[model samples]
Target: MEATSGMPRPELLQVADAVAREKGIDRDEVLGAMEQAIQKAGRSRYGHEHDIRAHIDRKTGEIKLARFIEVTDDIENDFTQMSLEQARIRDENINLGEFLIDPLPPIDFGRIAAQTAKQVIVQKVRDAERERQFEEYKDRTDEVINGVVKRVEFGNVLVDIGRAEAILRREELIPRETVRQGDRVRALILDVRREQRGPQIFLSRTHPTFMAKLFAQEVPEIYDGIIEIKSVARDPGSRAKISVLSSDSSIDPVGACVGMRGSRVQAVVAELQGEKIDIIQWSEDPATFVVNALAPAEVTKVVLDEETNRIEVVVPDDQLSLAIGRRGQNVRLASQLTGWDIDILTEEDESERRQEEARKRAEMFIKALDVDEVIAHLLVAEGFTSIEEVGYVPLAELAEIEGFEEEIAEELRNRARTFLSEEAERLQKRREELKVADDLVEFNGLSLAVVVRLGENDVKTLEDFADLASDELIEYIGDADNMTMDQANDLIMEARRKLGWFEGLEDETDETSEDAVEGEEA
Candidate 1:
């Protein structure tokens, strides 16, 4: 094993071996990097325009240096390409795509060339190290990793995790938790992304998943799959709630998470800087889950609007403040844990609201049905909430009520229908006054009041309504205004039908029209 100069340069192989061992990279990679460095130096010394290249023989540790020019029919770069006619003068057998190599005398190790070579090797090694780090940590995302704080920069902590350094951004740290150099930190690997500078390994101690993982570590039942963590909501360094379920009926999920004398939860709480933790039993029923999530605060009742995933929780007046917690944190965490939007109300407030609703219904019945207050009260008490229901209910059902005969039931039903028709005519006149488009008025799922409101909001055309998302439509007409997101979605879809955006709609219509024509002919 000797150099191309017939001199012993065994140091090259030894250096490659040492770099490969120390950097945990391939020996061939180091050798190839060295060749590139030598080639760069050769280009600098001979001429920058020459196509200089260097290759090292793997077994012999020998370096070969040469300048190469490609034989081409039409030469574009004179330094690296030659016309066939010009190449034929140099070699009669020259052909296109063949490299014409001229071996050069060995390069002397000049001070400047040595420095340039060192820089190239350093850059290549760094690139290899970055690639290795990315491969190592990319698969470890979502798992907790421990590291020592190497430095702090403008509040962001750079942690040294063995061979790699990961960044814990300022916001990723738990609120008010200060970290200093050399401190041992444990965090979830939230993201591992490759960027222009290098692969960025992002760590977070404040993520909800971090708290979930900590519980998993502390609870054996969770780790063994007997108990499962359903969801976690964290107000880092303040409080948190976790919902857990048990596969076995005998096992209490919440009790298991709490452990004997509250030891398990306290271990997690300590790790999270004494953040108060509430462990609740998970239920498939959304209302029940909401009830369980708002623990330590007595809830009188929970009414869930499944269409909106919103729950109205009525608590005892004394428990209202506690249920809502300081600045609404308890309700907020409960909402997050149950994945439901929550609205808290005191029992007294609930009773008042119920009374007000009943009063409105009674007045509406009295006015629309042309009935006495006693009869309207009877109708309202019987749970007939709207004119449409009274108009549509079976005559037998209405007559069966006390003090109601067939004649009275029939008259009430007729009055309900007449009132609905008059209301429709009024709304239609108002709709026209607002300049609502006829196409939008004909769209299914949008009521007359909704159409009038759309006109007021400048969403008068089918195109305008089609452009709105379900959420946008809900925002326009208020979420609590007798319209669900599903209904809004249906309206938008019907509006799109007018634009022929649905592929099968036209075909179905055509088929139905042809069937109707066939029936008429028969």
Candidate 2:
């Protein structure tokens, strides 16, 4: 057999260099791909069953093609492996793990072989380009990128961001923003994922962080760290709200974000395709922050429920519609900005609710303590909401109310305790009649009312309760009870513990089976 020349192919090395530079890949990888093409052609000339391998010199692009037969102690496949005794016959120093190399002659370039080689080289170069793109874009998530619109297909914009392409889906684009081909587009890199086809870089123009970054670029105070963006919410091409806080006491964060004569905000708005921007001052106090978030509408007062993170904002009658915005946009953005649920109310509505609550509290005190309306009204007016407060509050606190002495306070407290004791007895009887599970009754933080409601919902057994999700429990009880998802999870977990539903019995079963097998073996 004739041997191929071992001389360096300088033209081949030059081609490898050019392809590597064009594809933004390593030159050695390209040379390795070329060697693979040559090795495939060599295999066609030699036997296909032989263990053929290929390598290319990195500096000179000289291809070496050979067939390898590995020496083994117990040879199973003769095509790739040879026994140690057989290998020793060829070379006395041959080891069991070493390979016996056999050089093969190069192949003549046929039409089909050259086409197959070209295809292999092209595929390898394409794979390298994809790997390069994935590595380059995966770290760029959550960053702003500028690209040109390459084309539009089915409302999805394909952008050419210099080296690689990114996709901006229709839903990710700002509303009503026309992106024509060749137009410069700026968007936030929402995600970079390596899929089966290649790397997919998802871009978004409507994400809240995009607006925040735009402000960071536009406002010197924000960019310099004098002002920080606390939160941002957008209605896309319509309106957006950004809450900013100033670290320096003298700098007005809202004014700084707005810039001189609205220049800074207008630039962001123009980029967003005429999206109206509301620059709000941020506050640690959620109520104050919410008031600022719902701009162009005045709030009369704010009542915050710290336990549930809800804020009730009362505005004048005329400002109600404005506070809620068109279709509740104002209140919705305010809720998002402050990270709290907001309930907007008119001043008259709030006044009516207060009066009704006061009446109910006065009535409750009158019935529980056997007091007249005047005395009950006095207790209710002093912020005593329930018999529990009357029974547990210090005697001095009750006496501090107008027209109340120590003797009267002591009598009221005694009556409140008696009433609560009777109520507990009644509830205990009701629970017994309902056949509430003993385990549920004993579960800490599971109130009597909750157990009764659970019974009514057919969740009578611990097993039944354990089968329920947190939201299911909330649905059975009610959100008015102020039951949080965490509390519901705790209650359900307690029920599960009582039922031994998560005792890892399956794991124990596996261990027991293994032990049985070992005992038999012994």
Candidate 3:
């Protein structure tokens, strides 16, 4: 080791090694940072405009300082560029695009220069450390990681995860779960982002995937792919529901997750701060899955409305409270796990609703068909709830109704048709009075009744209807029409097309036709 100027200092290599070890960075990277710091110092000493550079020998730790001037045909920069003809005077081997390196003696560092060099080295080392941390943890998302809580700021926990620091946001912590400094915690790596400050590693204990990963760690069947976790829903430290499916028929997914004597599930529950878990067997059928998800409570029936992506669950009156759970937690978790909106109902409530619907239909039949109460009740009992059904069903189907003859069926059909025709005429008169345009009235998929309703809502012209959003149109039409969003969009687009809104766009019609075909296939 030498302290004199223009001499190699062997201690520099030892310093680089120590810094690399302490910072967890590559030795070569630390040496590069040292070289950059020396180069910055050299530039500050020798004119800043000069192309000054520095290098350190890996073997001897010898510092080399130089000014680089490119041998170019055109000299755009006096400090860094030199003409080839002028370069040949100094060295005959110099060629175009080659650099002429003029070595200079290394200078002793002053206090200010030494401090500046230290700052540069520290910044470069920190940058390398941040890059290393990001590369190490960026791909480790969704993995369970153990760390010690370093500190807490504004409810956010900063954990020291060995080589890096991760943040567990307050919202990501389980409800009512408290953590303090020096406490060991396990969480899932939800995300890793490269921000201006550094690479941010976000951890979450409340995420549903955290529980799934815990089960994977505790349950061999899940880790081995014998059982797959289909979905998970968590109410933080309170309760959770996990749906799983088994690939092997002999293996029961729920039983495997539960483990022998509840050992496996208890491990996960303990990690989750005593969160009660309900492990349910997943089914391909939505109805079956919903039933399985709502555990500890018996469901007598489940009616699925695929159009609305909702399910109506019917349970015994005594099971109502159990099905709903405290503050609707059970059904809410079930809905999240199954991805279906659930409406829980008791058997008594369902029965009353059925009777009420029947009564309404019977009254409608009595008024529309001019039938007595007995006839209306018969129609309702026979599942003929609409005048359209009575008018258009096969004559034999109506005649086959008990206590109804062919003549009576024929008479009922005639009366129903008359009532519908008269109603249509009345709606048409109303539509005319409301000044609804004929183009809108005759639009396909817009029934005369729907048109009248739209006119009542002041959507009389095709332009007005076209201006409405799908949801707005559905709202204005009311639920009686059962208009889906897609249907409403189609109707609006058709109106737009008729109003020349899509004019001069050659591909519009083709794209619309292709979409229609795809929709039909779907």
What TM-score, over all chains together, does every model reach?
A: 0.89, 0.91, 0.88
Q: Considering only N, C-alpha and C atoms within 3 Å, which residue pairs clash in candidate 2?
A: none
Tens digits of per-residue lDDT for model 3 on 1-522? 122235667999999999999999999999999889888898999988899888888988989888888999888899999999999999998789998888877868899889999999999999999999999999999999999999999999999999999999999999898999999999999999999998999999999999999999999999999999999999999999999999999998888899899999999999998999999999999999999999989999999989878999999999999999999999999999999999999999999999999999999988888889898999989988689999999999999998899999999999999999999999989998999998888778888889988999999988999999999999999955888887789889988898888786757888889999999999
**Model 3, backbone clash pairs (residues 3+ apart or across chains), number:** 0
Model 3 Cα shift for residue 32 (angstroms): 1.6
Predicted model with the maximum lDDT? 3
Clashes of each: 0, 0, 0
Candidate 3 residue-wise lDDT at 501: 80
lDDT of 1 by residue, 1-522 (tens): 122442446889999999988988889889989999999999999999999988887877778888998988877888999888888888888788888888887789799999999999999988888898899999998899899999999999999988899999999988899989999999999999999999999999999999989989999999899999999999999999999999999999988999999999999999899899999999999988999999989888889887877899999989988999999999999999989999999989999999898898999999898899899888888998898999999999999889999999999999999999999999899898999888888887678888887787889989999999998898776622588777788878877876978769778999999999999999
Instruction: Output the better candidate (2/3) by lDDT.
Output: 3
Using TM-score, give the best candidate's number: 2
- Badly placed stretches (over 4 Å) of model 2 are 1-5, 453-458, 469-486, 503-522
lDDT for each candidate structure: 0.89, 0.87, 0.92
Could you tell me the lDDT of residue 466 within candidate 2? Answer: 88
TM-score, candidate number 1: 0.89
Report the lDDT tens digits of candidate 2 across residue range 93-174: 8888999887765556799989989999999899899899889989988899999999999999999998999999999998
Error of 1 at 42 (Å): 0.7
Query: By lDDT, highest first, what's the ranking?
Result: 3, 1, 2
* Ranking of candidates on TM-score, top first: 2, 1, 3
Better of 2 and 3 by TM-score: 2
